[model samples]
Target: MFIEYIAQAPKEHQKYLKKMYQLLKEELPEATEKFSYGMPTFYWKKNVVHFADNTKHLGFYPTPTVITAFKENLTKYKFSKGAVQFPYSEPFDETLIREMVRFRKTELEELQ
Candidate 1:
């Protein structure tokens, strides 16, 4: 999925392409990576995250914990049960993603 998306993505999104891939892998070192429907998804005993660059936006596979933790900050963005739609024409919020990665990591650890 990741490789396919990488190949299909527009040249401008290449910068974010690498960054997003790196962050996901770094955040979930033990995650099993695979492609599904041309999307890159990571699984760590369960689904951790999935992402793809759409024609107009970059989408993050939404997790409830992420939505709850960043509700206030993400109010302006479009979201659904498990999807956050971020515009691809601009920069993504790296800080928020980093925080989410940390928060999810801890949450999963606690469950164990």
Candidate 2:
């Protein structure tokens, strides 16, 4: 489903989506993939993150708690309660993304 979703996105957005998919795949090796809220989602103990291609930016959903936890670092980007918008004109902060994903994974682990 994720592959199909990527394939159906605009040509220019494909690379970004693929890169995000690879990064999340590497970060969450044991996570399962599914479509939730019409976006590609990664789930471990629960939904860890989700990403989708939009008109001018890529929407990254890492949950509200994770978003708030990394609020200081997200000052440069546009973010809401549970989502962040990474513009197409800018490069992705892969390091920060990895850290957030790892933090979410740790949160899940501690819950069990």
Candidate 3:
């Protein structure tokens, strides 16, 4: 289902989506991955992140509070509610992605 989700995206966006998936998977080694809400979702205690390839940007869902915590660094990007949009024209910041996932993992661990 994960592979199918990526494969079904636009060819130009496939690389970005694949890269996002790989980054999250590598960062959260113990997390479980699955197709949830029709996108690739990485779950620790709950859904940690969900990413999708959009028309001209990659959508990152790390929850609203997480997005707000990183808002200062994400000023150049577009965001709303629980989603952040990183345009395909701009390089995806893997470091930011890694940080968000690590933060999510920690947050979840503390809750349990």
Candidate 4:
């Protein structure tokens, strides 16, 4: 289903979505993949992150707390309370993404 979601993305955005998927998976290997809110979602004890491909950008949903926590580092990208839009024309900040995902994982772990 995860692959299906990526494959169904706009042709121009598929590659970016795939890269995002890879980065999230690498950081949250123990998370289960599912379709939530109509996007590809990764869940551990709870939802960890979700990603969707848009016409011009990849939508990454890593919860509002993570967004606020990374606000300083995310200044270069477009972001909101719970989502960040990484433009298709630019390369993704792999390190930031990995760190964000790891941060989410730690948050979930703390809840235990």
Candidate 5:
């Protein structure tokens, strides 16, 4: 049931989701892709990042460290306490997404 919904979003959302998946794969080559809680999640050498799309916007679930680090850069966007809510009309920030991936990777590596 969850997998079906992730696979059956609208066309526009599908495009965005594809873009995000590709970008995450490129940025975090070591990460593995998984469908969890109806969202596309990336698991690196350890857990890294996750994201999902809604009818209105995309939800980026970076760790608290990521949110704190990018708090200043995210000022322009509509972010909740932790997640970054990117509307469909606006383009996704690939650079920032890459940065978060890199940051999480580094954190996980250090912990290990």
Candidate 6:
């Protein structure tokens, strides 16, 4: 489903979406993946995050808890209660993305 989703997305967006997928995959090697809300999502004990390609930005959904915790570090981008929009213009911030994923992973790990 994830491969099909990416394949059907616009040509220009595929690269960014693929990068997001790889980053998340690397960070959560143990996670199970599937399509959720029509977007690629990763889950461990529960849904950890989802990322999608938008017209002008890459949407990173790190759940509300992860987003709130990293709000300070994400001032430059647009973020809501549950997601962050990293603009296509700005260089992709891999480090920040990894930190957010790790934080969510830790939170989920501690829950059990």
1-112: candidate 6 lDDT, tens digit per residue: 6778788888878887888888888999999998788788998989999998888998999999998899999998999999999887777899999999999999999998
lDDT of each: 0.77, 0.94, 0.85, 0.91, 0.79, 0.89
Predicted candidate 2 versus true structure: per-residue lDDT over 6-95, tens digit per residue: 999999888989999999999999999998888899999899999999999999999999999999999999999999999988888999
**Residue 83 accuracy (lDDT) in model 1:** 76
User: Which tens-of-lDDT digit does each residue in 19-83 have in candidate 5?
Assistant: 87778878888767776666777877656888887889988888788898889989878886668
Q: In model 6, which regions exceed 4 Å deviation?
A: none
Model 3 TM-score, all chains together: 0.93
- Arrange candidates by TM-score, descending: 2, 4, 6, 3, 5, 1
Could you give candidate 3's per-residue lDDT for residues 35-83 as a string of tens digits?
A: 7887788887899899988899999999987887788878878988789
Estimate the TM-score for candidate 5: 0.87
Clashing pairs in 2: none
Residue-level error in angstroms, candidate 1, position 74: 0.8
Model 4, stretches more than 4 Å misplaced?
A: none
Clashes of 1: 2
Residue 5, model 4, lDDT: 81
Which pairs clash (backbone N, Cα, C closer than 3 Å) in model 1? 1-35, 62-82
lDDT (Cα, 0-100) at 53 in candidate 5 = 77
lDDT of 1: 0.77
Compute each candidate's TM-score over C-alphas.
Answer: 0.84, 0.97, 0.93, 0.96, 0.87, 0.94
For model 4, what is the alpha-carbon lDDT of residue 73?
97
- Which candidate's lDDT is highest? 2
Candidate 6: pairs in clash: none
Report residue 87 deviation for candidate 3 (angstroms): 0.8
Give the Cα error of residue 41 in candidate 1, in Å.
0.8
